[model samples]
Target: MTMSAHGRPLRGLADLRTLTGRSDTQIPAHKAYLRISFLELEKARRMQEIRTANDRFAVVNARFREIDAEIADILASLNGTAPRAHALEAPHRSAVGLRPVKRQFQISY
Candidate 1:
């Protein structure tokens, strides 16, 4: 069931007949193959979609961590001797802080 890069498309039994030249004898096999190939191709497409989404998420997570670290360093440098309340307003706040997060974890709504 190998396909050429620019091979003829078998849109249906008639199209398959034109491409293979001996369509009558192989009609049953061709029909079965069409069904199986369509299903298999669909499954593979879905798997690829999932892999792409996973890669995107990984990129997002890495970016988020990078931004978080950069902001933490900036905060530590700017307010080393400031009062706790002033520093609390920074993004890299204490463990219980509620600073607004950066757009490093964004998706289009």
Candidate 2:
């Protein structure tokens, strides 16, 4: 192998001949071919990864939106139920079990 100037791979003369059992004549042509193919493969892999991430984001976003709408509708129903409170009437914290029905939601009379 050639004595490299720095602590890099012996990417020259005798190294190439030993690596593939071919001579220096073949090294340039072989490296050029590998560079072209590797570039194309790298581009294809990146595009595939981007597509998979987008698909996952779409699914998660749809589920989030659905849950938000459900919560909004439930709160709206609670707001629509009353304009006052009494011993026989209450707010939804009791209805939804946050507070106890037996105790009443508030000291409404």
Candidate 3:
């Protein structure tokens, strides 16, 4: 009773052929169904991988943005100007719904 990521139960080749009500003599139909099932499973697996990669990219992008903000703050201070409002903002959740760890930066004049 293996289940797919979409919660659908996967069926064996025999079970699939039986469900089609095709007799053993109908080998072509069984082969066609098996190919279709294989393709569908492959598609689901690839899609899951893509989603995982997207989540990782989002986390990396968020970290880069935080670094940019820190750099901006340092530049402003060196120029004797006020820092941006978001310079010292609290850690926020990324697209993956995970909050990044807070980091402290010390700047010497």
RMSD of each: 23.8, 17.2, 26.0
Per-residue accuracy of model 3 over 12-99 as CA lDDT, tens digit each? 7666443455456556887899999999999999999999999999999999999999998888778965555665677885679666
Q: lDDT of each structure? A: 0.82, 0.81, 0.84
For residue 47, give model 2's deviation from the true position in Å.
Answer: 0.8
Model 2 lDDT tens row, 2-108? 76689686555655434455456555887899999999999999999999999999999999999999999998889877557657655445355465458645775
What's the best-to-worst order under lDDT? 3, 1, 2
- Off by more than 4 A, model 2: 1-27, 80-109
lDDT of 3 at 33: 97
Please name the candidate that would achieve the greatest lDDT relative to the true structure. 3
lDDT of 1 by residue, 1-109 (tens): 8776789654665544344445465558878999999999999999999999999999999999999999999888987776566444546646666768766876887
Q: What lDDT, from 0 to 1, does candidate 2 have?
A: 0.81
Q: How many pairs collide in each candidate, listed in order?
A: 0, 0, 0
